[model samples]
Target: MVKARSVVQRIHLLQLALQITFRRTPLGVGMQNECWGAVAAELARLRGETVVAYYGISLREFRELIKGNKLTPAVMRNRVMGFRTLRFAVEV
Candidate 1:
């Protein structure tokens, strides 16, 4: 059961990581795209993957990378919900 618990914990951490990255990073705001590499690295760490392999996932491959991580539908939905809220809030 420890394994299952860790997975849940990782997902929760990933949520917070994504939220904080999106909330803090100046992504797509007329800034250079270099920061996306940092965002992808942070997420890949939580997803237990190589940062280089997903270095540009934040650019436009987010869903693909998330699918490759094998997260559940609920986690996927939660991610989408959080992303939408954050994106809209930034635009306003």
Candidate 2:
């Protein structure tokens, strides 16, 4: 059986996956995809959960929610900056 992961842990895992996409070298891809939406859908299927627990949401809803929401370290940094400045601040 799979061990339960706390919300913080799960979020951190997604963040790491996204951070892997950051380009570290020219012509080399740091990560081709930060596929949170895909992973959650497949994992839920593997666990035989028709619907996600705790969140009371379905795979389809999860996909829609996470769409374009790549929560990487860089992305977090940008968000933190915005909060600190109380304004929209991000580089590209």
Candidate 3:
């Protein structure tokens, strides 16, 4: 339960960070606005349902990366959902 809460907190932090950093840019606008959609897709994938796309990743790959501690800030930067979670953060 504690671990689950931490994961939830991390997601929230990432979400807020994204909103603060990127909400105004075109890319950030699209990603931040659709962040919830990414979460929903992940849920569907968890249920073993077929998904066209989940957070910029295929269901299988998403499942694999999430295992153990594979999901990290660096890994998130490389993953679509991470960006989607914190989508629109960090300007180039």
Candidate 4:
């Protein structure tokens, strides 16, 4: 059975996965594309959830979501709570 992870925990896990993925020096386009799935799988493992639970979309869709500034850390925090809409606030 999978243990439940808190919102903060999930967000932190995602951040770490992104950092790890970005730090890699992939050799080619193919390898670079594969990084997305790698990160998703890593995140799923950390959260004790299936990759589909975090991102039910295809790898391309997930990549676009991240690259298009659609999925920020703040937005992910809301997503963990079942909120789909993105929210932004001036951090002070």
Q: CA RMSD for every model?
A: 11.6, 11.0, 14.1, 10.1
User: What's the CA error at residue 53 for candidate 2, in Å?
Assistant: 6.0
Find the candidate with the highest lDDT and give its number: 1
Q: What clash pairs does model 4 have?
A: none
TM-score of each: 0.26, 0.31, 0.22, 0.33
- Order by TM-score, highest first: 4, 2, 1, 3
Off by over 4 Å in 1: 1-22, 28-37, 43-48, 51-92
| Model 3 spans > 4 angstroms off | 1-54, 68-92
Error of 2 at 27 (Å): 19
- lDDT by residue for model 4 (1-92), tens: 33354465456444644454344343112224433345555666787866545533345544553453223343243232122212111111
Query: CA shift at 48, candidate 4, in angstroms?
Result: 2.7
lDDT of 2 by residue, 34-79 (tens): 2444443444456565425622444554554354344434444333
TM-score of 2: 0.31
lDDT of 3 by residue, 1-92 (tens): 11122343344436544543343322211223433343444454575643333233344543543331133333233344445445322221
| Model 2 steric clash total | 0
lDDT of 1: 0.41
Candidate 1, residues 1-92, lDDT tens digits: the string is 11122333345435544764455423321113323334545666777866434332233444544443333243244345356424423331
lDDT scores in order: 0.41, 0.37, 0.37, 0.41
Residue 18's lDDT in candidate 4:
48
**Model 4 clash tally?**
0
